[model samples]
Target: MLDHCNGHPLAIIALGGVLATKKSLDEWESVCKNIQSHLQGDEESYSGVYDVLAMSYYDLHYNLRPCFLHMGHFPEDSRIDVEKLYNLWIADGIVSSTQDQIGKERSLEDIADDYMNQLVQKGMIQVNRKVSDGRISSCSLHDLMRDYCLEMTREENFLQIMYIDEQQNASADALTDKARRVTMYVGKEDGQSVLKSLSGKFSSLRSLMFISTSTEQDEDEDSCEWIRTLCRRFKLLRVLDFEGRVVLKGTFPSEVGNLIYLRYLCLKGTRITELPSSIRKLKSLLLLDLRVSRVIIKLPNVLSEISLCWLYFPVRILSQEYDNTQGYEIEDGSQLILNKLSHLERVSEVDLDKVDVKSLLERTSMRNLSATCRQKKESLVPFLKSSTIKHLSLKIDAGLLTGNSEMLLSKSSSLRILHIDAGSWPVTQLTIRVDMFPCNLVELGFWYCKLSEDPMPVLEKLPNLRNLQLHICYGGVEMNCSDTSFPELTYLELDGLFFLNFRNVKMGGFPKLLEMAIYNCPLQKIPDALHPGINILCSSILDPLANEYRLRGKASEEVQIPNLNTASEEDQMPKLCEFPLLVLAIIPFVMLSFYFCRSKKH
Candidate 1:
């Protein structure tokens, strides 16, 4: 298989995928011989391996063909997030939602997830990473497979890819009527030249994605004239995804509102400072991704059509950066709150902490939000009860996690998921009163809050909390879980607590806990609540005998462990004897202990 593949990755994966379905050894032998015959007999200059790969592609489930093929639109080997890709697929109506899936109470996203998992299992796609929820968060295709995909893209006009490094390849074929989707991978600084050269060529284009491969300053990107021209030319565009690489030093042109049919507009990693007030004209816009764009502020208020927004940065940073430019408007101690662009309403789902509470009240359509910008306690107090917010993640840097959170609970009584990530401040205990958290919170994840005091008694009262994750970055002595606490929690994940004392478990303690994962912790004993569900991770365990010896104050064992190199001395693995038994003891508790044992022995 290796020899026939001739160092091509796609062929190897395709061969493996085909063989996985063939259970008989004779069938495998026949398939292997036939593949070698094809490779040896082929005289064409094109990749012989693509023949094998084409079989895999053709064998794909018919419903997934278009969805898989459409991936050619993205740059080769792009790390496409599942959220982004699934949304794109759904937006394009590539995956049809069946009644069977719906009958199982599965969403289209759930069915799509199943499809992606099957594709990965069949070696058609590669999984990059999985999140805590056991969902594939990101994925990438092999370069060779991406090349084959691009070849098919050219033949079927699926999407046009223009390589800036190879100007000769940038032909009129891309500007033809068939080219509906075009992606410009700017590998050189001459993108301005290329754009100017291809001026008026994109008439019928629907989707235009720009991926900047050049690190140099793209000055042309800052100008509104080129953008206006592009928007004016491509009046029928539905998706304009810059992939957040273009740094718009100026305002996003008002001409963008002219594209009445636009649905998805992503400018996540850009330096876009403001949105022109004219943007409210986009009546068809569904998603507006402005996440991580620190310079953005003063959004147009007339947008009632937008359903989802991805703005995660704080607004204070925007005020700080642009305040000097508008120095003439400076007043007394308070910064002038940028009001909404008139009385427009219904802005849903955002991280708009930087916006004034007065203006936030007008945005009555807010759903789940994660805000980093701090607001005056009094100013935020009223809306806590008035708002119908569900999931809330407040990144309170000024130690507001312990603030009067009861105001939050009172206002957003319908809150379900609450994530509080403590900022730079060092908190050692729960300062907020017992009634701060809402009784209906179903999930909670806290990060970096040093909460020295265990407030389990308060959290225990939350009747709906089914999942809880605590991630403390620094060293901590212990966190005590009291009797009958977290009774409804189905999943409990604790990380970075050096010591954890599960001191007590009264009758019916954690009655619904199906899984418990502990990481980077030194838990000496198993709690009475421990069942087959408890998972003491490899990174958290120590050999009982070794720990006992250490308790007896002896480092007598000559156990050698690999030492991590601090200096750049060719990464030599020198021996060190400090607690190798931790590595040895971690074997039995692994998810599949027998598999781990076999691998360790091998």
Candidate 2:
């Protein structure tokens, strides 16, 4: 079957994907026979490869076909955020609702994740990046695959892409009005004009995306007009994405409330400082992303009227400054009161100092929380006692995790991933004990805690930890790991530990480790032995053992250790010398001699 592919990479990949699900030899034989039949007349042409790619698409189930086509809506070569894609799929009904055998309903996000995994297994989609816990964060399609998807979308009248520029020759007649989704790539300076041109054209549009292609600054006066136009015209919009594309001046346009049918609204990376009261009118909104936006002082209680499943805000937006003179009152205080939104499941970067953690948990159905404790004396015990929260990120003073409060984390049986950052505060000594961590944690990280002792002895006992990161969290000179420790650990990262020792790492330690990274750390050797396929990354400088391993030629396939001497070696090579002065002096004489020779010839 591969021989018929003419050694084409895409064909081989597509063919492998097509055959991956076939269980019986008869089915594989039938597929190969069909491919041969397609290539009978034109074996040298790429039509056979196209057939293989098409077969992979056609193999998708009815529910997954639309989800696959939706990938075409993103800009070419851009990494599509998987979380955003899931929301879009849910909003568009591409990820259909399902129920288990016991008649319990399943969430749309779960179904979208399943569909994405199926496509990934079939090689129709490529994973671009993953989070530390082994879940995909972003993904992309190959250029050839993206082209195929675009062609299918055009044929199905699913979506249209417009590159908004002066030279664009697309006429109203040429642009299909049936395409329910439209993506516009335009310069920041031409944002308003482009929006004006696209108005009322695709009245049936269900999704609209504005992607900025230029770095030019935007004129805010004209910016809100386009948004108002969008709300008034595209009344049926389900997904409105302006991520990093526009700055909504000082406030969100009240006109957006007109899109009552909107489900996913992304304002990420924008400069909007405030949300209008009218946003409460979006009763159908499911996801609102304000990550990396300018500070928003207050969140209106009216937002509880909407059914939001995922809400992300900038870290400092919800944090407030206490006015000691005013007693318990804060200056421009922001209260996170989303208790009425029963469907809300995830919220990030909430200020625990102002918001009661226990009250927030009991009032809402949120299971994923990211909060910050800015007050130096704030208790972290409330956060550690919760057994419902699955993913937690806490940025607090280092001293807050001491004694009984630190031991409370082990009570969080439901926690899967945890990150603690105490970089802002000064602490003389901090100790980490094995009993202080939840046994079920799959990923854990510590930053700037300046621990007085080595944590490896405690961390290795975690039965389920797969990813571990220590960024200047230890102050000791030496550390040791017992043999056969870290049975489930796969990735380990050490950063900013300039004088730490690695000589004590046992050969059998980190038995299941697949990758290790050393950054800004001067180490002479790694563990004596490791798995054959393990990957080692040394960012700053490679020590003697690493250099020797690299020289052995076995490191070429699995290791990413940078060769620091390459630049210096190239610099040391001999160079050509120039006699510019002598050449300049002879130039005039040579010119005069040439003139005399010409006269003699005349």
Could you say which candidate leads in TM-score?
2
Worst ten in a row by lDDT for model 1: 563-572
Off by over 4 Å in 1: 1-49, 95-108, 165-177, 187-191, 216-221, 306-349, 352-419, 423-450, 453-602
Per-residue lDDT of model 2, residues 1-602, tens digit only: 87666677877887888898899999998887777444222434766666676677777788788889889878789999998788788788676557978996565556777888888988888997776566788999988788788878877888888876655433332488777888777665434666666766776888987777767666553355567766887889999988747555455688999999999888776666566778889999988876634444344556668888777765552112222211121224655556677777677666666664544676435667776664644446655666656566665556567666676678776667766666342322567788888888888887655566678888889999999998766645687888868989988988766557676777788888877877655466565655555677754322333334445554323474432222333332223342454365346334533443453366
On lDDT, the candidate that comes out on top is: 2
Give each model's whole-structure lDDT. 0.56, 0.68
**What's the number of clashes in each of the models?**
4, 0
Q: Per-residue lDDT tens digits of candidate 1, residues 1-602? A: 55666667667777788778789989777776665443322445334676666656666777676667667766666787777776556555564445673473334556778889877866778887654335788888887677767666777777776655645245434446557777777644333545664566656788777777766755455544467777777888878876535555566788998888876777656666666767667766655665524343446544433433322232232123242332111113233242432222223233334345665555444444544434444544545565544445443433554445545653576555556555443332334444676776677766655454554666676777787887663233444455567767877777655445544556456776665655645554546543434433223323232243234343233322222112222222222563485456454333223332343366
TM-score, one value per model: 0.59, 0.79
